[model samples]
Target: MTPEALSGETLRLADAVAADLEGVERLGVAYSGGVDSATLLALAVRALGPERVVALLGVSPSLAARERTIAHRVADLIGAEVVEIRTHEGEREEYRRNDVDRCFYCKDELFTRIDDEVARELGLDAVAYGENADDAQRPDRPGAEAATQHRVLRPLARIGMVKPQVRDVARVLSLPVADKPAAPCLASRIPHGQEVTPEKLAQIEQLEAALIDAGFSDCRVRHHGDIARLELPADELPRAVAPGIREQLQRAGKDAGFRHVALDLGGMQSGAFTLQILNARGSL
Candidate 1:
C-alpha cells in the first residue's frame, strides 16, 4: 500500500485509540521509542493529555543506550511523563539460558514490574503496550505471550493497526522514529542456547556501532564464539566486501574481540540465525 493509504488508516486507528482512552483517568504506556510505541504514545497524549499519560521504559542491560536516548527524546517531544524502570531480566535464569523463548521471561519480568510497580506507584488506570496486528502472525515473538499474561492492554492491536500503519501515524505526528529500522535487544545477536554475557553484548554493540559509523546502516553483528558474522543489506554487500572496506571491518571486529570476521553474502535477513536453525530442523 502507498504511504498515503497507510496514513489514512492510521488516522482512523488514532481516532479509535483516542476513543479507547476516553475513560482512562491515568494511562501507562510501555514505550520503547520505536515507531509503534511512539505512535501509540503520541495518540495517547492527545487523548488523555500529557498529565494523564505516563511512558514507562524498562531499562535493562540488553537495551541499547541509543534506544533509551530515543525513547527519552520521543517522550520529551510529546510532553509525556517518562518513567525509567530497571528490569532484572538478565538476572533471571530462564532469560540467561537464552532459549528461543528467552524473550518470554524477559518480557514477563518487564511487564510484571511495570504492572505492579510503575502502574501502582503512579496510580495509572491501565497498562498498555504497542503490539500491532502484524505481530500476531509472528510465531517467534515470545514477548507477546508475556503481554497477554500480564494483561497489558494493546490499543494498537485492538484497533487493527500494523507496522506500516504505526509508521504512518508516526509520520503524521512528525516522530523522528517514523522510519527507523527495528532494533531489538543486544542479546538477540547471540544464538539461542548460548549464555548471554555482558562482554558479548558489549562486543556486539561496539561492532554494530562501528559498522554504522562506516556507513552500513542496516546491519547485524552476529556473535558465534570467536567468529563475528556481519550481515549487511543486500545492496551494501558489494561495498562491505570491497577489499579496503573488508580489511577495515576485519580490523574493527578484531578490536571488538572477535578472532575472525566474515560478511554474510546471503544479505541482511532479520532473525537469520533463527531461520537457519529452523530450516535445519525442517521447521521452516
Candidate 2:
C-alpha cells in the first residue's frame, strides 16, 4: 500500500484506540519504547493530553540498557510522563526457569506493579499496553496472557492495527521509533530451559551493543553458553563474513566472553528460537 494510504489507515485505527479510552480519566501505558507501545502512547497523549497519560517503563535484567535509554527519549518526545519501575522477574524462580511461559511471569510482575501501585498512586483509571494485531495473532507471545489476566488494555490490537500499519502512523506522527526494529528483552536471546542469568543477559547486551555500533540496525546474539550465535539480516550476511568486519565482530564476541562465535546462516528473525520450540510442539 502507498505510504499515505497506510498512514490514513493507521490514523483511523489510532482514533479507534483513542475512542476506546475516551471514558478513562487517566491512563497508564505499559510502554517499552517499541514502535507498538510508543505509537499507542502517542495516541493516548493526543486523546487525553499529556497530563492524563503516563508511560510506565519496566526496568529489569531482561531489558537492555540501550532500549531503556531510548525509551525515556521517546517518552520525552511524546510528551508523556515516564515512570521507571524496577521489575524483579529475574528473581522470580518461575521466570528464571526460562520456560515457554517465562514472558507470562515477567509481564505479570510488570502489570502487578502498575495496577497495584503505579496506577493507584497516579490515580489512573485504566492501564493499557501495546499489543498490535500481528502480535495477538502470533503464537509465541505469552505476555499477552498476563495482560489479559491483569485486565490491562490493548488499544492497538483491539483496533485491528498490525505492525506495518503502526509504523505507517508513527512515521506520520514523526515518532523517533517509526522504523525502530523489534528488540525483545535480553532474556529472549537464551534458549528455553537454559536458566536465565544476569551474566548471560549482560553478555548479550554487550555483544548486541557492539554489533549496533558496528552499524547493524537489527541483530540478535543468541547465548549458547561459551558460544555466541550471531543472527544478522540476510542482506547483511555479507558484512558478517566480510574481511576486517568479520575480525572486528570476532573480537567483540571474544571481549563479551564468548569462546566461539558463529553466525547463523538462517539470518535474523525475532523469536526464532521460541518459534522453533513452539512449532516443534505444534503450539502454532
Candidate 3:
C-alpha cells in the first residue's frame, strides 16, 4: 500500500520508515514472524517493492516449528520471498552457557551467518530487524547489542514506533499476527544457568503447542529441568484449573517428558527469566 493509502499517524509512521529505507536497492529483514518483524517486513515491501525485499528467517533448535511455519506464511502474505538460514548458535559454548548475554551470542551467530553466507549471494544492500521503541529501551535484550554491532537497521525503533504502533501498523496492513502475543525463543523458557539443548527445546515446544491446541490462546511451557511450569493469561487461569483442562494439561506435560506440571498463578510473563536475572543483578 502506498503512503497515501494510509492516513494520520500510521501514515506518518509509514512515511518515516520508507524514508529511512530510501536508496537501498535491495533489503533483507531479519524476520521471526512475530508482529514486530511482520510489520517491518510489510512496511519494507510497501516501500521497496516485494521484488527488492527478502525475509531472512534464522532456523535453529531455539525456533519453534510452529513459528517457522508462521514466518513462511507471513512472508507469503506480505509478498516477500522467504530465505531460511540455518544458524548454529547451539554449537557456541557461550549460547549454551545460558547467561544473560546468551541472546548476544545467538544473534551474533545469526548475523555472522548472514554476513558470510547470505548478503553477497542475495545482493542485499542493507539488513534490518523488528526492534521497536520499547525493545530498544529494554535492558533485557542483549540481542539488540549484537544488532548494533552488526549495524542492522532498526527502522521502527529509529522512528520511535513502540509495540502498540507496530501492532497498529500490522492492523493497517492486515497482517495475521497483529494481536499475537510475544513468543520468545524456546530457549528463553529455560532459566539462566540451565544449558540450552535441543531436547529441552523440543519438550518446551511440544507442551506449548499442546497448550495452544488445548484452547489456551496465550501460554508458556517454561522448562525447569523435569518440571514443566505452565503459565497462562490471568483470565484463563480458572479454565486451566477446571478438571478436564487440568487433566489434559497434566497429560500433555507428561507426554512432553516432564516429571511434574505446575501452574504459575502470576500468569504468562514476557521475558520472565531474563528480567528475573537482570533484576537480581540490579541491572535494571
* Model number with the top lDDT: 3
Clashing pairs in 3: none
Clashing residue pairs in candidate 2 (N, C-alpha, C atoms within 3 angstroms): none
- Per-candidate clashes come to 0, 0, 0
Candidate 2 off by > 4 Å: 1-10
lDDT of each: 0.85, 0.90, 0.93
- Candidate 2, residues 78-120, lDDT tens digits: the string is 8889999888998899999899989999999999888777778
- Each prediction's TM-score versus the true structure: 0.92, 0.95, 0.98
Best-performing candidate as measured by TM-score: 3
Q: What's the ranking of the predictions by lDDT, best on top? A: 3, 2, 1
Give the Cα error of residue 206 in candidate 2, in Å: 0.5
**Tens digits of lDDT, candidate 1, 1-284:** 12243345666777799887778899999889988888889888887788888999999878888789989997898788899999998888888889788889988998888876777789988888888889876767889999888888888888888888788778878888999988888888999989988899889988998898888877888999999998888889999878789888999999999999988888877876566666777865
Clashing pairs in 1: none
Using alpha carbons, what is the TM-score of model 3? 0.98
Candidate 3, residues 57-165, lDDT tens digits: the string is: 9999899999999999988988899999999999999999899999999999999999999999999989999999999888999999999999999999999999999
